[model samples]
Target: MYKNLTITSLLGALTIILGAFGAHALKKQLSVEAMQSFETAVRYQMYHVLVLLVINLYDGFSEKMKRTLTLLFTAGILFFSGSIYLINLFGVSAKSIWFITPLGGLLFIMGWSLLFYKFLKISLQK
Candidate 1:
């Protein structure tokens, strides 16, 4: 849990810094559409980072669940946000990689599903 917390906290901080930089530093250079996409990615990344933090807060997460959630969160951060950052920094025509965003979204959904399953198991045991 500590490891997950530490990493997610760092990732969250990075997201905030990058979001600010994107808003102020890159806004002038990027196309409006690219900038919007970048902002959207940052928004979703930050939201999921918080959700991961909450999942870690739960003391009952098994080791498997922890590992799965961590992987999912990492994938979401990399693919979803990373794609947007790249799209803004480079021309969209250069890269044909927009499909990664949905994969990242699926990871985020899986993370939530894992959490729900854990909750259900606990409720049943009680």
Candidate 2:
């Protein structure tokens, strides 16, 4: 639990730092489209970080479920945001790694779908 918390906290800080870096430092270096993509990555990363934090605090989920959700969201952020950062910062060819971004989005969808399924089970119980 503490490990998850620590990871999530670090991710949150990293998200903020990257967002600021892109805005202030990379603004002039990157094209408008690249800058927009960078911002999208930062936003999605922060959004997932927030969800991970909440999942850590919420006690309703079994430990296994929590861990699974955390892994999914974490991987999603890394694949999605990390790829964009690589492309914008290192001039990596997006065509080479295009599949990765969609895979990340799929992870996010799976995580959310699992959560929704759990909620449905709980709702039906009452």
For model 1, state the Cα shift of residue 74 in Å.
Answer: 1.4
Give the C-alpha miss distance for residue 32 in model 1, angstroms: 2.5
Q: Write down the lDDT of every candidate, Cα atoms only.
A: 0.82, 0.94
Put down candidate 2 lDDT per residue, 1-126, tens digits, no spaces: 778889999999999999999999999999999999999999999999999999988888888888999999999999989999999989999999999999999999999999899889988999
TM per candidate = 0.87, 0.97
Give the runs in model 1 whose Cα sits over 4 Å from its true position.
92-95
The digit string of per-residue lDDT tens for model 1 on 4-109 reads: 8898899899989988999899889878887788889899889988887887787788767877888888898888788777767766642588588777778788
Clashes of each: 0, 0
TM-score of 1: 0.87
Considering summed lDDT, which 10 consecutive residues are worst modelled in model 2? 56-65
